[model samples]
Target: MKMICMAVMLFITLLSAGAQKNIPASDIKTAMMKATRFMVEKVSNRGGYLWNYSPDFSRCWGELEAKPSMIWIEAGTPAMGNVFLNAYQLTGESYYLKAAQAAADALIWGQHPSGGWPYMLDFSGEISLKQWYSKVQKGYIHCAQEHAHYYGNCTYDDAATYDSGMFLLRMYLLTLDPKYKYPVERCLDFVLESQYPIGGWPQRYPLRYEYVKGDKEDYTSFITINDGVHTNNINFLLACYTLLGETRALEPLQRAMTCVLALQGGKPQAGWAMQHKLDLNYSPGHARDFEPAGYAATATAEMCRNLMRFYRWTGDTKYLARIPDAFEFLESIRYSDAQMKQLGKSVKPGQILCPTFVEVGTNRPLYLHNDPDHYWVDYDYHGLITHYSSTRAIDLQSLKDEYQHLLSLSKEEATKDSPFIGQTDISGTLLSHLMRGKVQQADTQKVDSLLTILKKKDYLPGRLPSVSKENPGFSDAPLPSEVISIKEYMNGMSTFIQYLTK
Candidate 1:
């Protein structure tokens, strides 16, 4: 009996040791080099990038803000910027630093006087300057007369300027460069002011409260929910609070959470709307003719997660307590497997169809669309280019998993949600290790091996992200190869190095 017990203990000890020592430092270094090469060789243009690149190493035209000749896609800029930062830290390489700095300089040049970045940046000085001059004539920017600035509509729509601004701030923190600091500060201030008095943010600021054209109008100046705007905005605030020690950040965050809490609608079926009315009421508000005010499962799930994050950061029980209400609404609307079968879609048994939007009170799914030619459905100037709004039935696996995890959590676990919580798995684990001051003894052999796989496939610049969308109506453009997305490259390599090095 004694011998059997001893054997069992020995086996357990061996298992623990084997599980922990999975990564190596040397392989991580090699992965870093290959990723750095890709960023420098294939990802960059004249100090900027097209929104997405093709595998064939050809530049793709911008999808939203990209132009054929000289546009820098804003969506992917931060990914490249952070990759350069990681390379510099990993190798102490001046080459990576130079690349990172040049991107910073471009960001500075493109910084709008309104304190945000445009969707895309055009590097051709004369064209950008001339455009700003046109805005100057309209007095959109008082300083436009003083100097030409990139004045594309400063927006937080779909994580626009906010993401770009945060990346610049991260760079500023490490490099302590003056150029990065000024824009970061201004952008943050703009973000703060963009918050509506009701504590939610408009997709764009200085508030284009209503969209009116051809006798059709709807309010757009309300708090936004699409693309995780509220969650992303408050996350930015939390980042400032945690890293910058910006105490003033707390007020806006609290107000924003309070706004979210109040706007959860009413009983048995209370969930969040995609866009809440601007009057501080809980009622759903219209956005673009097709996106009728409706309860959004995607936005609600994200908000609950972020609220838990806020509660963790603030020790504020209010944020934690508010999550169950959201959970209930999500539960009430679950699409049963039988119903999914009727749709005849390839859905799994446990899987549910989380409608992109649902009827506010009935908890029924909402379907909507309108010809943009007749109405001001899109708030941006490029509204005509958007496809008609369509209903989306997305996989609810992630949200379902997160909901179950939240149900099992104690207060202690709730507070642990963070920026690093849901990032790339290996990188986030490495960050957790580094934060604990455990790097010297960490098991890097496994992580290094994993990174090697990541380099060959993820960091490979073989396929371009330029899809066959009509990005430009009239341009002598070459055909593009359908390949892995910019996200795979950007998120894959950028996050890996940031976690390992930072």
Candidate 2:
């Protein structure tokens, strides 16, 4: 009788704990609204939303980076516009509609000649003819990058076909413009034609272009083929095809998905590497020429995320079947306690090809940097939180528990006499806690306090801080008194908002 009573009591306690885990919808909405407004205010300007805007309306960057501009326009602009769209949907506010239209106009103006966008743009109307060629040459680094740049440039070459197609698809969806449909169809046809016999798209088409103009034609041919199915390219292509509801897309997507599956690293493997004319070997952890292989984890995770979406749209069991493998791959790369202690909380993980990092001291995987590149890994707090929210295999309860652990760990680190003061990781960890949906009112207050400190210190500026190797400062970069360009920050914030809204 005593044992039975004890067991029953324990069960009830667990049930109560589980019940308490859910965050109130009202509270979530409030926090989300506040954060959204803060982000929007940081990006918006008289012309439109600049990519990045500091809290004081000074210090923005990448208003000129054309590629980022298109990404912002495609990913972020829609997000901000959607906020108003959502408002209109719920409350029938004309103000939201006006804001959405303005955002759309700004994005449309950012488009390049080829119906594509450049990676960067000079917001100043001072792009010379020489600069134009320079931008064009740089844009041809890879098919996807070129496409991104091309879409911004408003060009209609074969290079811009895939990304341009996606943009067109989005435009068609947004404006119900029949004009977009023709381009989208044409681009899809081009993409299908470009696929290799092995069922993969190349990193870039006509790959013979040397890195330098004077260099010997690297492949001794006018057209060089980077015929490998990269994760991003494959995902984007799959997404476009899936969106188009094209029967042709199904096979290619499946093949690409399967190929990605075959690339998974473990004791037991799936497929072997194939011989190709172009250097197709890009793997994780091997430090070679500029084409490093170690940036696979995040890529794989992103691909899986896209595949999940593809499955969602197509209801294809095969796409669904691959989810577990991809999930397992993500799990395997998760930075363990051993890995965390090895990598440290301050120093970013060495060339992370993985999605989630094991929070220091707690050993729970939380999404952090997507790339191993120092400049690129500048504390992607929003991406991490978004990935955590989107992951289906990982239960919400586990996420909340891990988030709490990360929060406690961050608080502990902040109080310590550590070297990494005003680092973005601190903010990222705090953001993770907020996203966990389990923060107590007191904890939320603490987060707000820390955020205030970070904001006042100008630590949240979107640009990479120039750290001195000889004498690193408390903060990486000085706060700008005048506003920088707005492209990068607006684009980044908009990307974050779009992900959340979706």
Winner by TM-score:
1
* Best model number under lDDT: 1
lDDT of 1: 0.59
Question: Model 2, range 1-502, lDDT digits (tens) per residue?
Answer: 9999999999999998776544343443444344445444444542244344444543333322232222244233534454444444444445545565555455455554333333333344334423543554443222122322222222222223333344445555556767656655655665565556555554334322343223222221211112222443454455554455567766766666555444443322111121123334422221112212233333444445544444433344454454555445445545455654544332232322233322222323333333322212222334432222211222323323433443354443433421123333333333222112111233333334433433444223345222101111212356543343333323332332333344
- Candidate 2, which segments miss by more than 4 Å at Cα? 1-49, 53-59, 63-88, 102-115, 121-126, 129-171, 179-197, 202-208, 212-248, 261-291, 300-340, 345-502
List TM-score per model, in order. 0.70, 0.45
Model 1: per-residue Cα lDDT at residue 232: 70
lDDT of each: 0.59, 0.39
